[model samples]
Target: MRTQVVIVGAGPSGLLLGQLLHKAGVDAVILERQSPDYVLGRIRAGVLEQVTLDVLAQAGVDQRMNKEGLVHTGFDLLFKGERHRIDLSGLTGGQKVMVYGQTEVTRDLMDARQAAGLTTIYEADDVQIHDFDSDHPSVSYSKNGKTQTISCDFIAGCDGFHGVCRASVPRKSIQEFEKVYPFGWLGVLSDTPPVHEELIYANSPRGFALCSQRSLTRSRYYLQVPLTDKVEQWSDDAFWGELRNRLDPEARENLVTGTSIEKSIAPLRSFVTEPMRFGTLFLAGDAAHIVPPTGAKGLNLAATDVKYLSDALIEACVEKSHAGIDHYSTRCLARIWRAERFSWWFTSLMHRFPDQGEIGQKFQEAELDYLIHSEAGSRTVAENYVGLPLNFGE
Candidate 1:
C-alpha cells in the first residue's frame, strides 16, 4: 500500500490529523496496535480550551461536542478553608473551556474517519517504520501473520510515550527532559451530580484534591496520594471521606457520594523531547511530551501538536511548500515549553511535598492567598487555562 502520509496511531491526535488532512485533499492511512474497543475504553480527562474546540471544528467533528459538552466560565480554588472563584471568561476577554470527555472526542473523530471511509488498520502487530531518514520512507506491520508494507511521503508518530515511533529514534539524536513527582492522583468517576456547577481545585493540610466533571450528571474527582499507595488500598467510602476533608465547608455540605464506576492511581510527571521531527517522521501528542494533569494540558498539547503537524503536512503535500514543515519543531517547542512551565508551576503550587515540610505549607498558603486576592495572578491562571493562542511563525 502507498499513501501520502502514514499515521501510526488511531488515538485522537492521529485520528484528528487524518480527518483534517482528508478535508484538505490529502490521503493518509492510520495504523493502531489495539482494537477499537480498547482505544475507546481508555478514560481520559477532557478540558477543551478555545484552541482545541476550534481544532475539533476544523476537523468537522464538533457537532456532538457542541451539543453535549458543558461550558464553564469559571472555577474555584479552595485553600485555607476558603473557596475563591476565578472567572475564566472575565479574565480572558470571554474565553472559556468545555468540560467534555476525551473518550467522546475520540469517538467523534473515529466516527468521522469511518464515515469518510479512511483506512485505519487496528490490531496491527510489530509495526515498523523504515527509511524515514531518506525521502523514500515506508511503514510495515503484521496483520493476520502477513507482512504488509506502506510507502508514504511522511509518517506521523502519535502512538504515545511507549509507542514505537519515538522509540525508533536513535538515542543520540534525541534529548529528553523529565521530572517524576513523588505523589500520584487517585481519581474516581461516578454517575453523580457535581458538588458545584464548576470545577473546584483544593489544597488542604491532608493533600490536594480536584472536583471535576464530565457533565451535569457525571463527575470525576481526584485526591493526592503517596507514590507508594495502591488503588486497592482505598475503598470508595474511604476515598469519599478523605475527599470531604480536603474540600471547603460548603463543598462538603453539597458533596454527593455514590458508588464509583472507575478508579485508578496515576503518577504525575513532566516529560518533553526536543525537536519533534526526525527526518520524515514527526511525533505528536504523548509521543513527544507529557504534562502533569494539574493544569489539564496533556490532551490540549497533543491537539495543538497535531494541528500544527496537519497544517505542515498539508502544505508539504498539497501546496508543495516545505516552509511550514521547516518551522514545525521550533514553533511547537516554543509553545510547548510555556505549557510545561505552567503545568510544573501549578503542580508545585497545589501538591504537598513530603520533602518541603511545614515551611512548604506556609509558603504555599501565602502564595495561594496572593494568587486568589490579586487580579493579576488570577488573570494569569485564566489565560493559561484557556490556552495561549497558536503561534505558527506568523
Candidate 2:
C-alpha cells in the first residue's frame, strides 16, 4: 500500500488530521490498534474549547456536534458554600466551551472519513513505523494475523503516550519534561441528571470535586484522591458520600444518585517533549505531550496540533519544500507550552497535595476564597477555560 501520509492512531488527532488532509486533496491512510466499536465507545474528554468547535465547523464535521453538544457561557467555583461564576464570554470576548464527549467527536470524524471513501484499518496490530528520515517512510502492521506494509511520504505519530511511535525516535534526540501529581481523578458517569446548569469546581475540606454534565440524561463527575487509591475500594455508597461532602452541601439534596454507568481512575500528570517533529515523522497530541485534566485542555491541545500539522503537510506536498515540516517542532511547541502552563496552574489551584503542610493548605484555601470572591481572579479562570488561541506561526 502507498499513500502521501500514514497516520498511526484513530483517536481525535489522527482522525482529524486525516480528514483535514483529505479535504485538501491529500491521500492518507489511518491505522488503529483498537476495534472500531471500542474506539467509538471509549469515554474520555467532554469539554470542547471554542477554537476546537470552530475548527470542527470549518472542517465540516460539526453537523452532529452543533446539534448534540451543550453550550455554556460560564462555570461556577464553589468554596465555603459560596458560588462564584466565571463568565467566559465576558473575559474571552465571545468565547465559550461546548460539552461534547471525545467519543462522539471520534464517531463523527470516523463516519465522515468512511463516507468520503477513506481507508482506515482498525484492529491493526504490530504497527511499526520505519525510515521516517527516508523519502519513503512506511508503516507495517498486522490485521487478522496477516502482516502488511503501507508506505508513505510522511508518518504522523498520533498513537498517544504509550504507543511505540514516540519511542521509535532515538532517546538522545528527545528531551522530556514531566511532573506527576500526588493526586489522581476518580471519574464516573451516571444516568442521573446534573444538579447544576453549569459545571462546578468545588473546594472542600474533603478534597476537590468537579460537577459536569455529559448530556441532559447523563452526568459526569470527578473527585481528587490519592494516586494510590483503587476504584474497587470506593463503593457506590462511599462515592456518593464523598461527592456530597465535596460539592455544595445545599445542592446535595438535588444531586440525584444513580448506579454508576462507568468508573475509572486516571493519574494526574503534565508532560511535554521538546521539538515535536523528527525528520518526516511528526508527533502530535498525546504522542508529543500530556496535560493534567484540570483545565480540560488535552483534547483541545490535540486538535490544535492536527490543525497546524495538516497545514504544514499540505504546504510541504504542494509547494515541494520541507520548510513547513522543518519548522513543525518549534511551531507546535509554543502553543503546546502555553496549554501546559494553563493546565498546571489549574491543577495546582484545585487539587490538594498530600505533601502540602498545614500552612500550604491554609494558603490554598485562601487562594480559593480570593478566586471565588474577586472579579479579576474569576476573569483569569474564564480566559484560561475558554482557551488561548494557538500561535501557529511560532
User: Best candidate per lDDT, number?
Assistant: 1
Clashes of 1: 0
lDDT by residue (53-158, candidate 1, tens digit) is 9999999999999999999999999899999999999999999999999999999999999999889999999999999999999999999999999999999999
Which candidate wins on TM-score?
1
- What are the per-residue Cα lDDT tens digits for candidate 2 across 1-394? 8899999999989999999999898999999999999888778889999889987986789999999999999998887676778888887788899999999999899999999999999999999999987787899999888999998899999999998799999999889999988889998899999989889988766778999988998999999988789999998788899899887766797899889989999998999998788888999999999999987999998998898899899999878777878878887888888889989987877767777766666787789878767878877788878887775343
lDDT for predicted candidate 1 compared with the true structure:
0.94
Q: What is the TM-score of each candidate against the true structure?
A: 0.99, 0.97
CA lDDT for candidate 2: 0.88
Worst 10 residues of 2 by lDDT: 385-394
User: What local lDDT score does residue 52 receive in model 1, on the 0 to 100 scale?
Assistant: 97
